[model samples]
Target chain A: MEEKNGATSKAGDWRSYERVLLPPVRDLHRLEVYEQNGGYEALREVLTSDKWDPTSVTNEVRNSGLRGRGGAGFLTGLKWTFMPPVDPNIPRFLCGNGDESEPGTFKDRQLMEFNPHLIFEGMLIASYAMSITTSYLYVRGEFADWISLMEVELAKAYEKGYVGKNVLGTDFSTDLVIHKGAGAYICGEESSLMISLEGERPYPRAKPPFPAQRGLWNYPTTINNVETLACVPLIINRGGEWFADLGSHRHPGPVLYGISGHVNRPGVYEYPTGMLITDLIYDVAKGMRGSKKLKAVVPGGSSTPILRADQIDGVTMDAETLRDAGSMMGTAGMLIMDEDTDIVSWLRRVTRFYHHESCGQCTPCREGTGWIENIVTRIDEGAGNLRDLDLLIDLCFQMEGRTVCALADAAAWPVRFTIERFRDEFEARCRPSLVPSGGVLTPALGP
Target chain B: MTDFIKDPVILMPERHPEPVFSTEELVFTAEETRQIATWVSQYPTADGAIMKVLWMAQEKFGFLPPEVIRLSAGALGMPYARAFGVATFYTQYFKSKKGRYVLDVCTCFSCQICGGYDMLHYLEEKLGAHAGETTDDGLFTIQEVECLGACGSAPMLQITNGPYVMNLTEEKIDALIDALKRDQLPFFSSVTLPQDEDDLGGNRRTDVRDTLTYSAPPVAKTLG
Candidate 1:
């Protein structure tokens, strides 16, 4: 937590930190350029060499300690192991989740646009390890341009015998298809993504039947984030031990920290996990815009709890560190807010987003999101009493753990945590109670 | 208090409306039929290709009316109601007529904190139409949309759900509206990261034809 800005390099400069996911190579999106920079070599090595098998590859990823980059920080290799043993009679699928629709997250877009071949290579490697014949990359429809670009690149890969039947002349055969999702945030969820791929309304399924057990079309499937798959090739090439020693010991490997909102340099920076929050905002993002005092920071995407400026003194960008700091490392897309930002209006907007994207599947989520949005908007408009604050918190409790998916919890967390952390701000916007004493009416009122 | 406790209503789509296209026009062209067949082959079941085929239909036609949705469902050999449900679930699928250009302004959390509503209001005033309404001239429609995954370039808007015009300003909006008036679409501009400016000579992508550098976001005019 002592500002590990230059810890990775002897030069004591954060810029010296090497970018693994998005290397400093130009034209990496093209097949030839990516191959020149050691792109599909990992896939080629895995398919041809006797050193790696399905189990060994999974073990390497598990040993690397790489977690899911799409909000949930579950172990990628462990998730792969959950898949029932491969059967030739049944078809298994590997879904590369490119549905990067989270409000404050945009790093996956950069990866899909600029370094698409890395993702393809990673997917191919993962397919070989999982013994999956067909893989689907579900990209959000808003990324039509990127999707098209990736399609062209994928076709080239297929033509070169990297993805289609009999990959690299080995027995390993896999088909990688790019499935475009029409604008739904819920499809970003693993089960919902599978349902969307199967041409159904994308409502998230219950957790008893996880994706690995029964996924797309009721086949054993494993879903990995686009950025998470992009790391597979790196782990294969450089060894899992090297990846394990790259960043935070608990959550190792390079992560794409997408810094946005009130920052001078608001863009995706590839640094190892566990980068200091202060260094990210101050040093990496070139300090706050116009030198404004930092008021709060949403440590991850909008669903992650917002941290007061004082509370993030020694916070780092890792799952455990952020969890210990009373937030989740949900995508690591930090939305920084300056002192001038109105907390009430900001929370209102955040609540409105959840309300707008509730998907209407569960009663708690559909109704709870609407109720939360109405209450927060009233508080924002200075038309609420002090009791409304308590009411809002109570509403969150009703919705938090009583839903089909995390969307309800996502809707509830911002309202609950924002009021808990910034009660003074919400109280200032609300009208004072008419009855002064708690549970006691004034004598004048009785008269 | 009345606003907070409003009753919920399920507004139904038109059950029987005048058809926009005739029976002859509803049929897909031979080339389009071949394309749909190719999409169907990629999925495990024919239904999996419903979204791609529907997207193609929306592209060929201006929007998806009930008949058009039925046409797409028939092309995929699926039920019409299933396709309709899919279309309604996604906001990108145009269920009705829209302007030549649909400007999706991102006013989500990141953009909101960085003057997203300011740009949205500017467009509303310039076009004489509020969000979700097409302009009177039928040239544009301004929609205040959720995040399009480009939060780094806050205050951005997507033109016709296509190219993103990022890091928006008043002057940029004026120029964009004028160009769009003349039926000239803006070029795709790649946003270069700040680290690329120092390490890789201002732009990291050599394949990109145009690039926009990231700068400090402008302050919001009104938080509300």
Candidate 2:
């Protein structure tokens, strides 16, 4: 388990590095351009190739060991297998989650905007694998531009007979539908995404009646992230083994890391999933914005716990590796903060996001997210008492596993981590001098 | 001094009554009807057309008044209660009147640290309207949002009915507002607008990859 920073960590050998989704070409948003540059080749192969049925395609993916790129690294094959036997009498469906609402994440938008057909090819493969002849791509509102861009590309695909009846001159017919989501982050969650498609309030549903078992108008369905589905075509085009061999152990294949914040160059970097955090920020991102030292990093999306600069050393950028380092690679959206950052204020803003996003489904998340934000806001405003420090962690603990959705857990991570790892930073900002006379602190300190 | 639940914007956004459509019968023009029909054609079940139908109504009549919601409900073949529920639940839909120019500032963690709050204050001072308040002349409204998924730009604001302005500074804000008010929005923010307007169209990449890269042994050679 040897680890190194910057230059040495990446090992220069990019021979296996594959950019299936994001290619280094411009004007590819148009169908003609995309087709010219090897787009839709996988779908054409799948339709016209020899003896490749649903089970074999699923087996190829299973062998590839491709995990869901959407936060939970669940094996795509295993999840697809979870679907109850589809009654041919009733239609089964597949939904692509284009609801890129996760804060600190923007990879999906880039993929869809630039290479829309890649998503379509991926959907075509997925539809074949699960016998899901009909598919829907769900892009949320406020992303009207994304909806517009996807619509244009989808039209071209349909007109070319790539999608819609008798695709590529085959008996199997697959139709691709695009669904627009109203502004709701919870809808990005699979269960909620199903409900949103049915034109309902975007509240996440309970599991056990998982979408795979019964989804979208009470039929069996599978929902995957936009990036996850976009990878399917690649898996089909390239051999699964070659795809699996693209990354470090455990986390395999190329991933789109949306690196943002105080870095000199904040852009999406397509690389193997397990690049070191230092390499992404220092080498690939070209270093911090100014002369300031790196202080903290949210190695995943905003919901993930912040890793102190020291903790980021040798930390590979993947789900298992990040989880081993006490954070989940939920979206791989690294938000970098510099030394001059006021950590308490930053955490307060983070808490505010979860508070705003909590769907009010369960009492704990409904109440606890706002409670954490309030306490953190109090601390940032120079009123946090020593006991309030414990209060923040306790509130987060109560909220973690008690909610219907993971939004509660997302809210809890930043609070618990900041209190546990950066207690001094919290203490430095807990200005007892600003605590009201004979108020919130009087009972704890004296009586 | 309790702030456990005192966030006005989070708890209650500034609301205006449903009057625009109440004053007259809500009707879609032939063009709007054709657009709505096109969106409906994409879905197998018409229920999937609700969001897009709402988008059509909003486009025709700036904000989604109750009457417009009703029209969208009818267009999607869903009940009015269901359409209202969908409309009220999401943040993008405007139930009330909005200024001609709406500025939705993303104040989430990534944006906050990178001068999002500063931009908020500057907008408030310049517009004389806080987050959710429309200016007297009905020119501008500043609203707060969780995130726009543009964290790569740090602090950013999306111009409603227009494009997103990213990596914003105070002076840039002034220049943007000037161009916007003068109705001469020249080429400014590359983060939102199309790349070349001719060739590489639709939300082109703005910043180049500036992070330096380090090399190690090949991933396949080392791990495989």
Candidate 3:
């Protein structure tokens, strides 16, 4: 609950922290407007001058403490270092994951929609860092409109020599293709995204071949989230130390907090990480709708564990604070619930989403999600028994850590956490067991 | 009724349905072929372009019938089964015929909390079609979908996988349905943050024409 003064100025104002990802530049999606506002300056500086090189760029990002904004919060610079040292004979690839399908997460969509060139610019810088010639920006199929907008902007970037072959008239060359994903949430998982790019059913592959080593046609590949890559230019421009100093020391840098549900004004707000969750729910989002008391919160996306209102009293939005508070800063898509919200029904709907979207790749995830949804549905419908609650918990244990990807874990966390945290609500809905726990039934002698 | 049952039924797609498009109509145009070629060259192998090609096919033919999927696979020179599996895996690539306007009502957690189901039920009652069913008029299809990532503007529905009509009320739904019946698609409304209203003069992006200011979510008529 300790407040970090990183985002506040001497005047103790929250608005003092400026927006880097979604800047206030008018028509920034346009290449000309972007260039006028120092859009490609980072890429230009990195490409043209001998002052910067690939390793230095990676080092700079590492120094910035920029974590992947997609969900995992892994250091972007460290991830860049994972690529097997570039071989002239071998080809390397980078996939910009724009599959922002996680529910309660819509920051990437707005970022992609408004300031596309920044993403393209970031991609160019990333390509130069990794010696990648071609990169794919994997956008979800639901974002067809955003894809079209990016396509127009990307073509404009290409025509202006900002992207495509020979970026900025230098020897360094890179190309970005906008790959549209069909409506599968699993594709947001990096390996599955690679498989989807390879024209397969988007099943996540087992790790240790880990995308950095082998991916996309079995070549060396690196996939960074869209927002993660978007921060690269700022890291390059402002110097890593400056970028690292903006947010919490551990998880520093500006983050787009997509606050939604039951708030008076729910929208994507850019703020430095480590802003108090209370400040976010109250001051930033303009408090609860209808002056209702806070009930519960899904601190990150739907996948992250839901926390009771009291649990988030002094918690900040950074990954470490949220993790310590028993929820991860997952995509920073905070779903706020008011006192009137129905926990059981909400959990049921969330379980149903996991069931519906499970790729059916692993038996645990495929079967477990369906089973979990069914149990929750029955519980929500006032069906029998306290044992079912135990069964739900048991099913979560069985599903977690048993699948190839984290999808199973993601599916289990919300169900397990919601039930564990809101047991009273769920228990109230269920009828007691017919048989006493220690009582034994007499066998029929005639039989 | 509870979804929990001893025997769960798995609905299968029709193995062989009547062809919606003729052989002549099924073929991609020369321009489309060239566009497909550009996409094909973008990838190291033709397989990588399968999704994009299938998307293009879906756009051209409306939905991916078996023959159209085959056509797409044939265009990419990949296996038909592979194309079919890819087609079936993703929900957006519709395998069957749909009404002109598919109202994908988002009833995910955030939207659900903010009357997503209420908006869905309202549409169901008004249109006389349950979720996932097309109206007899063949103009509208109501679908209860998962999140489309527009949680900020909850209780929203997308029109035929295009523009999102967000911040829904019964009146807005009525107007939307009326407009759609008259062949009007909703324009994309960029919902701005409250912070932007205070700092950036209401909107950050000046290029966007239609913008919506975020407001308090409406209370649900039914929590379910």
Candidate 4:
């Protein structure tokens, strides 16, 4: 993918060849305007038209290579394919992840808030594909308006015959309900979400009986992120080939790259995955918003490693390249930090959030994130011995991929990366205070 | 919390003799009410549908006012406090009063890392009140919220009545505020095919194909 360096008279600014994602200024967030602007048409088509086969819809998405936009970047279609074929005789479910709790990730919230109809359309399509009569949009508790938006639109959908039984006058039918989570980050994970939806403690269940085969009341179900569902209609309308052309084969389709940090044009830029980091960082965002020097960027939200200026070049906002650089695009949450920012303090803050949100279900994450938080906090507050650095690093290693879910790993990854790439900084910050104490030995290093 | 959770609304036509109010503060159109009833009937018991019904009522009415909550409670055979607790517990369901348009700023960890603080500050200044406080004009209210899940676009804010403007900047914030002030909300592109042409006002007769074809593709617009 080619990158553009500067602005042009043409809307041709970001890339010589890129389409402005979901264009045309509609009512800022009103469902009425959404209706006026061609929202729910695809769903109307699928429900009302003769060609409403759910299998072909799933096939089109599978061919599109559109991964889950919420985080993890897993293939959306592949996940849907895992659904035990929906038997109308049985009850199957689809839960939309409105729980956008991942640190440095907010794309799902945006998708629902701005273009709620997109999710409604996606929900209907998925329900139609999976033959699910009942679907739920488990929106985060914080999006007060979005929940309302979903309600209004849902009401409209039913009134218009786009939802409810005999949808669009077809034999197939699905009903969508918007459920709200009580402000918990852990709920973003599928099993945890299922647990919460089932009115239990928000604890994750063991997988392989993954949500697809056995989920939500122990029935076969499909749980998807808001963005993943939002991408469904596009794949159906534009065809898989056209969708694949947007990003790389490995991570195809247009990704909503949310550029932040000290950039002038910080906003979500929808583009193909392979767009070069240098072009995105400097040109598209117009560099750091203030005069702050670019120090590092937490490449795919806080869960991914922190990348310095040198690493910015050649980086692609896709899964494989991000992994090659020793980071996963856990969620396409790119948080940029400048030289003026304090990395230690930043990590401490992020760690604190994770600690508070640990859910305490797993011993590793429940205890591990808490320990990391204490060490990082001590380090940030300028009361740490050099030995504390290694201790924190060791805890991170132990925590990675060890828990029942990714929460522990999400908390540990940033700490691990910060220590490895910026150990000297951590050491320098800790040593001066320690030297004054005349300590004979440092703290033990391993966890 | 227990009571609110048990019964999400207090007003109902059956349980209580009178309507929730003499006049509807947030009147639902006949069509909108029918939509609500359709969902209400889906529950095995009327009380089971209280949470969703209140959600629909709160949405129809700007805030879940006392009357509305009571009405919902009565309708669902729920305790008033139970309805209140459910309404208050979920941040999405507002408990306090609000302006005609409320701007929910995303202060989730991701947005915080991505200039969310600055955005909140900017909105506070623009709205002339701190978060959770409505503006003097009563046209707008600004509040900070946890993740709206647009992590990709940090520093974003939801103009209560608008989409999530991600990768947000001060300039974008300014434009959003101005647009809200002018009631110049962004359009929402969708199609509505009424069950019957006569079900709604004559407004239900547009061709979705023509309207959708002329509209910009889904990815082009903002997600609030």
Best by DockQ: 1
Q: What DockQ does candidate 3 have relative to the true complex?
A: 0.69
- Per-residue lDDT, model 4, residue A432, is 46
How would you encode candidate 3's per-residue C-alpha lDDT over A1-447 as one tens digit per residue?
234433332112456877788887766777888889998999999998887999999999999999999899998999999999889998899999999989999999989988898888888899999999989999998888889899999998889998877777788888899999989999999999999999988889999788888998899999999999999999999999998888677888888999999999899988888888889888888899999999998988999999999898668888877787899988999999999888999999999999998989899999999989988998899884666777788889999999999999999999999999999999999887654333333221221
Estimate, for each residue in B1-224, the C-alpha lDDT of model 3 and write its tens digit: 68576576876676766788888898889999999999999999998999999889888888989999999999999999999989999988898899998999999988998999999999999999999999998998899999999999888998877888889999999998888878877777777766667767877667677899888888876766
Taking all chains together, each candidate's TM-score versus the true structure is: 0.95, 0.88, 0.94, 0.71
Write candidate 2's Cα lDDT for B34-95 as tens digits.
87787777666787778878877776788887878888898777899999988888887888
- How well is each residue in A1-447 modelled by candidate 1, as lDDT tens digits? 344433232112445787888888877788988888987899989988889999999999999999999999999989989989878999999999999998999999988878999999999999988999999999999998889899999999999999898998987889999999888888898888998999877888898788888899999999999999999999999999999887688888888999999999989988988888898999989999999999999988999999999888777788877888789999999999999999999999998899899899899899988988998898888887777788788789889889878988888888889999999999999887665445332332321
Of 2 and 3, which scores higher on TM-score? 3
The worst-scoring run of ten residues by lDDT in candidate 3 chain A lies at A438-447
A45 Cα displacement, candidate 3 (Å): 0.5
Off by over 4 Å in 3: A1-13, A435-447, B1-17
| RMSD of candidates 1 onward, in order | 4.4, 7.5, 4.8, 10.5
Winner of 3 and 4 under TM-score: 3
TM-score of chain B of each: 0.92, 0.74, 0.91, 0.67
Candidate 2: list runs displaced more than 4 Å: A1-18, A431-447, B1-18, B22-24, B34-38, B184-224
Worst 10 residues of 2 chain A by lDDT: A3-12
lDDT of 4 by residue, B83-179 (tens): 7655554455666668978787876554565567777787788778988888888988887765565554455666553444555567877786788
Model 1 — interface RMS deviation?
1.0
lDDT of 4 by residue, A33-102 (tens): 7667666677777666666577878888888888987778888888888988656576888998878777
| Model 4 complex DockQ against the native | 0.13
Question: What lDDT does each candidate get?
Answer: 0.89, 0.77, 0.88, 0.68
